[model samples]
Target: MTTNTRAWRWGQLLALTLGALSSLHCVELPTKSYSCSSAEDCQGLSGPGGVSYVCGSGGWCEAPAGSACPQASTPPTCSTSNWCWDNPLSEGRNLITVRGRSATDIWAVGERGIALHWDGTCWARILPGNSQQLRAAWPAAGQTWWFAGAGGSLLTWDGANWTSQALAEQVTFHDIEGASGTSAIAVGQAGALYTFNGQQWRPQSWDAGTSPAPDLLAVWPVSNTEAWAVGRNGTVVRGVDGGWSRVSNPTSVDLVAIAPGADAGTAYAVGRGVLATYANSTWTASSFATSTTPLNGVWTSAGVTRIVGPASNIFVLGSATPEPSGTSQVLNSIWGNDTSLWAVGGSGSIVRRAGGQWSEFPGGVARTINAIWGTDDRNLWAVGDQDLIMRRVDERWSPAAPPEPGAFRALWGSGDTLLAAENNPTATGGSNGKIHLFQNGQWTPSASFPSNGVNAFWGTGLAPVWAVGTGGLIRRRDEAGTWLTEGNPNTASAQFNAVWGVPNAEVWAVGAGGAIFRRDVSGSWVSQRPSGATELFGVWGTGSRDVWAVGLNGSAWRYDGTTWTQVSTGVTQTLRAIAGRSTDSVWAVGDNGTITYWNGSTWMPQVSGVSENLRAVWVTQTSVWVAGANGTVLRLPL
Candidate 1:
């Protein structure tokens, strides 16, 4: 690899689009300008992805190190803020449940006390400082809101402060709802049911003579006296006048969420492979032909029914039109009436539907980054979760058009041909494995893969890439563009995480149980375990005789063409990915922001400045990039 001659600047990394990131009203940027007369005029100015601006000679705020650049060889001194965020424009936190009075006033809550408020125009992040995984929220219009979650966490937001109330510490509330500040209801595990009536909290008996009281998962409140709760084994109950009675359900699958329909006596409920409708006090059920993933939320208004579930899937009844949700993450909860709709899901995904179409809110592409790859400083690819293929071309990051619906795991490019391993969860039972090819700006599905999910890709920068994934399945794509399985075609009980090739030599794959497998000349697999670690996440090598592997608990090992020996790295954080520029320089990154380097001698630790787990790392001549959870990317100039 050759070093990039152009001077790279921090000004380009500062092009952060601050759409809905900060919770503090002060740090939140206002409507800004795009032109500038001097560098001082561009100060404190930024765009999407939080990328800051610099004054160019054209009297406009320009990115990418400004118009007049410095020589890459003559770099400036490093700043304290080395690692920074580059995508989603904010700290992307998973939002599980959303509630409020209307579109203008909204509260979307997630685990670990993460919440956000939408005031029609802007979204502000709110971290309540509670580490417990929150499961439910009842945003009661005004300042007063209710929250309950794991460990029986029950707290109230009274505009100015959050107040916790005593409750069973072992029970986890899964869902909560309230009519106003005075009335609300929450249902949870182990048939857990609680009621709030403005003054004191009370535990209500919800069995009404059912066995073990099926763990209630969802609750809907019509009035203080009338409420409905649903749970496992298709259990549904109606409470009136302080008495709970069991109701008939059409399916045995667990009902996760329910919503009243447009009609007075109509309702819609969805869950695992089950969709049911209730009208005139009778229940009927069916399943989606195109989806088997559990449906999480349902909404109905003005005779229109909409359902949201895994894979950012959204569809409306009557029309049954599959709307592009702009995300591939699973949607956990959806809200709104007919014209305006909001669906929040995994990894900070927020999408809205209006004017008979769906548009994104810019938080979905930052889902857990699994892998990062690029051939040059001008081109890089990051792929993960629900069809996310973000490309950084010419120093700008944008998403490529997604291929067939699936969760992308690994990405590699050879010349103009880009290959991505996609876990197609649209299948019935589990994910079906497939490889997608990106050429000429479009993604096309390749032949079917043997495993259920592909994890990593490694090979020469040419045809015949080696792919390894779940089920201990190994496959290779030859020059003819045909995928041929190399290992046992039916042996699928184990999972492989990473793979590497030795040019014209053997291929190596590492996975759980410290499994190190090498393909011989005859294509036979030989397993070796020099370091009896529990799990190995990544593997790479400099040559046929010189190879390295990193895995659980900071485990590292090197092969001398004969055997593997364990090497100590001095840290216990699990290393996920390993990449090297040569035998003299290598980098490994993993959990808790751990970044270690091998200087052809001893292993040394480097400061990452963030605690978010780093999953993927890429080494180039000028810079090293690390990607991980919460849309974090740290850059260290080499």
Candidate 2:
């Protein structure tokens, strides 16, 4: 076809797809074809929204570049103090190890080459070019730092730029400790050990008495002549007389971290539910009366000792028991001065214990958000596993109580009245589906259904609510606040996943095995199965005639007041939820940080910058909110 003719046809197609003629003139097309064999050939071609065109599989330039959405130039404004992407006061990345010269100069390292520095007030991120997970970090002499991590990543920061070092062998480095300006010891997986002596890093060999070496995880250097290293399978080695010798390991747990104790000739080691102390050349098992969580890092200073572990656990010796931290994220590393202590862990969790009370910071709750609902952007509710419910008020997310303890599957509501569907297991080895209501700042048990599980919820308000679940179960709440079971209409038993509707009794529910049902004015659901047997997980629409459903294997279907037609999403990730503000602008999120946007005609993928599974999405006129596994919460302005 001629270039002008094709452009005209494309404009017409977009106009028809959006059901509007006003947007027809905005469909800018290239006058000449860009020659390309792959998508890279079309790079830098100007398109809408400062985006570049990409070469499609058909060798044509497609609108919207394959880059992440543009970062906000300014941080979001909120009435209350909250953590946003641009204002990164709190850590949102998993931290593995922490070290510092003093309280004013602290460093924490973690996955994705994350390095954070604390300047006595707040934390700031330092980007190391490599994306490898940094497992260990230590301070050297005078503003110099050393970092070792996965894939043989050994980096040195000379108070300015980070430089990578070449090593003899390519292996992951777990721990590094500096004894002096010219000497340091590092250990890693599979018994790999190396020492840095001013000029270069050289491999160190140890004599194993006919036993396979275990993976070393941590190293602590007391002096040039005395150092200790701990590893998997209860391996503990001490350095003396310029040589390493095996020390008695008291526990079989894989020792992850070691630290000096309160006094001389005393050290502590902790790992997988085991804590051990070495005193006067003898090892003894130590125990904590309160916790058994797998410990990761230990630190001691000013006659005080602290141990941190999974589930936000921090045990302080010689201190009274404080309140529970109330966070579920695993604590990976800890550091402190005499008066204050800080712990970091999975999902960007950072907590501080000061004045004998543990208080959580604003960043890093890595719990998967299964469902999100709100009256608007500021007033929102998100539900997830372990009875986790969060409320976003004035842009900050805080914990909210659920009616009971169970994983929530879906949430929907209007002003002042919200409902959550939960699948609570019964004592008889079966499931009990319950609907919890939130109103007036409290959560209460509202209703229960006979279904084994409740998966999705939809409602115009509190009066007429619909819930779908396993085995083709459907239930509804009428205006009289009474719950009633609407029998399954599908011929086959399909697990319903999501439901959405508009006014006038037009509701659509989609589920596994390609099951699609719609409720009529008579309150009876009728099957509306489309071709193919793909399991659908999410459904939403701007109106009755404009609806979309997404499912497994990148399958998507759209309804335009007629038969449902399949829409092609280039990737095959399992999409879990979809939301939008208008017919021409919609989004769908799924596993492995997949986010696809429907720009009126085609579904284009957008980079989320995370590898966690996204489970739910909520949209407002000017913003989009997505929640997913590992306490991940993302927001973007429309």
Estimate the overall C-alpha local distance difference test score of candidate 2: 0.70
Q: How high is the CA lDDT of each candidate model? A: 0.69, 0.70
RMSD for each model, in Å, please? 10.5, 14.2
lDDT of 2 by residue, 1-638 (tens): 00001111121112222211112112222323343468776666543333566765434454443231232111332211121242122325678887777877777788777777766634556667667989888777778888998888689887678898868778999999878867889999888888777777888778645355788889888887788999887788888756887777787778899998999989898987778888888877655443466778788968978777757356776777533444577788877788777777876666666655554443334455688876445345678876666554223354444566688888876544567888877787666788887554445687776546888888766768888887677778898767787855352376789988886558888988888887877877888888884899999997768889999988899988778999997768999999887788888989987888898989988877666788888876556888888777777776
Scored by lDDT, the top model is: 2
> Least lDDT summed over 10 consecutive residues: which range in candidate 1?
67-76
- Candidate 2 TM-score versus the reference: 0.68
RMSD of 1: 10.5
TM-scores for all candidates: the values are 0.59, 0.68
Worst window of 10 by summed lDDT in candidate 2: 1-10
lDDT of 1 by residue, 403-480 (tens): 654577887766546778887653455557788875544456775664367888877654567888877668788887
